[model samples]
Target: MKFLSSLFAIAACGLLAASVFAAEQAPQLSGCAAKRQDITTQIENAKAAGNAGQQAGLEKALSEMNANCTDADLLKQQEQKVLDAKREVSRRQADLNKAMSKGDPEKIDKRKDKLAESRKELQDEQEKLEKVQPDEDDD
Candidate 1:
C-alpha cells in the first residue's frame, strides 16, 4: 500500500508539472502581431508621404499598440476560451464519428450540425479579431 501511494503521488506531481508548463507556453496572438507589423509599415508610408492627417492616424495606431497591442493578459484569456470551445467541438465530432460507425444516421446528422455551429462561432471570433483596426480615424 505504501508503494502504491508513492507511485500515485509521483504521477500526480508529473501531471501538475506538465499542466504548469503547458500554461506557461500558452498560445499567443501571432495574428495580432502580424497585423501590428503591417500597421507599422503603413505608418512609415504615411510618414514618407508627409501627410499630417495620415501621421495623426499612425499615432493613433501606435497608441492602440501601447494600449491593446502589448496587453497579453486579455489575449491569453480569449485564446484559452477559443481553445476550450475547440475541445468541446472535437468531443462532439468524436461522438459524431461513433454514431456514424454505429449506423445511427439521425444522430450523425445532428452532431454534424452542432459541429458546424461550433466552427461558425470560432470563425466569427477569428474574423472579428482580424477586423480590429488600431486607428479609429476613417478618412
Candidate 2:
C-alpha cells in the first residue's frame, strides 16, 4: 500500500512538471489555426455520419496527416506530443495493473478513465493534424 502510494505520488509530480514545461514551450499556431479548425470540422462530420468503414478510413487519413504535416518542426513536435501522451498512458495502465493485482478496485477504475482520456487526446491531436492538410482523395 505504501509503495503504491509512493509510486502514484511520483507519477503525479512528474506529470505536473511535464505539463508545466509543455505549457511554457507551447507552439504558436496563429497562422494555421483556422485551417486546422476546418479540418477538424470535416473529421467530426465524417464521424457523425454513422458509417463505420468511412470512420475507420478517416482515422487512418488523420494519422497520415499527423505523420506528414506541413510545418517540419511543428510536425516533429506534434509527433513527440503523441509519443509522450502514449507513454504516460502506458505508465498509468501499468500502475493500474499493479493496483488491481493488489485488489484496488477504485484505483483501477480511475486508471481506466485516465487511459480513455489519454486515447481521446491522441485522437484529437490526429484530427487537428488532418485539418491542417489538403485532402487528396475522397475515401
Candidate 3:
C-alpha cells in the first residue's frame, strides 16, 4: 500500500509540473498585442545591428503606434492599419522579386525604395498594435 501511494504522489507531481510548463509556453497576447511584441523585437534587432537609418524609421513608427494604439475605440482602425501594412509589404515584395528577375537596374532600385517604404509602414503598424493596452476585463 505504501508503494502504491508513493507512485500516486509522483504521478501527481509530474502532472503538476506538466501543467506549469504548458501554462508558461502558452501565448499571453492576442491580436495587436502579439504583433506589437514582434515589432518591438525587430526594432531591438535593428538597434543592435547599428543600423541608424532603420532604427530611426522604427522609432518614428513606434511613436505613431504609441499615439493611436492606446484608445479602445481605435482597435478596429489599428487592426486595419496592420492589414494594410501587410498588404503593402506583400505588394512591395512582389515588385522587388519581379524587378530582380528582370535584372533591370532602374526597376530594381525603384522596387527597393518601395520595399523599404513598405517595411517602414509595417513597423509603424506593428508599433501601434503593440501599444494597445489590454482591456480591463482581460485581467
Candidate 4:
C-alpha cells in the first residue's frame, strides 16, 4: 500500500511538472490542434485526479471535436467572440461616460477599471480571431 501510494504521488507530481513546463513553453498551437490538445490535457488531468465525471465530459468534448469540428465553423465562432467583445467594450465605454458625467472620482475609477478589463478581453478575443483566420485560409 505504501509503495502504491508513493508511486501515485510521483506520477501526479510528474504530470504537474509537465503541465507547468508545457504552459511555460507556450507553443502557439491554433485551430483544431489547439482545441484537441486542450481537451486532451483536461482529460488527462481529470483522470489523474480520479474525477470520473470530468474525464467523461472531456471525452465527450473530444469526440465532438473529432466529429463535427470544422475550420469554417471555428472561424465563425472566433468572429462572433470578437463581435461580442466589441459590444462589451462599447457598453463599458458607455458606463465610463455615465460615470464621468456624474463627476464622482470613485465611480469614475471603478468604471475605468471595468472598461480596461473589457478592453483587454476584447483585445485578447481579437488576437484569437486573428489566429483562427490562418486556419480558415489554409483550407
Q: Name the weakest run of 10 consecutive residues (lDDT summed) in model 4.
A: 130-139
lDDT of 3 by residue, 4-56 (tens): 99999999999999999997998677554555666787799998999889988
As a whole number from 0 to 100, the lDDT of residue 19 in candidate 2 is: 99
- What local lDDT does model 2 show for residue 5? 100
**Across residues 90-139, which tens digit of lDDT does each residue of candidate 4 receive?**
99999999999999999999999999999999999999887767644457
* Candidate 2 residue pairs in backbone clash: 39-131
Residue lDDT tens for model 1, 31-137: 46655766787888888998879888887987787577543554565566677777877887898889899988899899899889888877766654444423335
Residue lDDT tens for model 2, 70-115: 5555556666777887787788778778878988789889888888
Q: Which of candidates 2 and 4 is the stronger one according to TM-score?
A: 4
lDDT scores for all predictions? 0.73, 0.71, 0.82, 0.91
Note each model's CA RMSD in angstroms. 16.5, 21.0, 11.0, 6.3
Q: Which portions of model 4 miss their true places by more than 4 Å?
A: 1-27, 135-139
Q: What is the TM-score of candidate 2?
A: 0.44
Q: Identify the candidate with maximal TM-score.
A: 4
lDDT-best of 2 and 3: 3
Whole-model lDDT, candidate 4?
Answer: 0.91
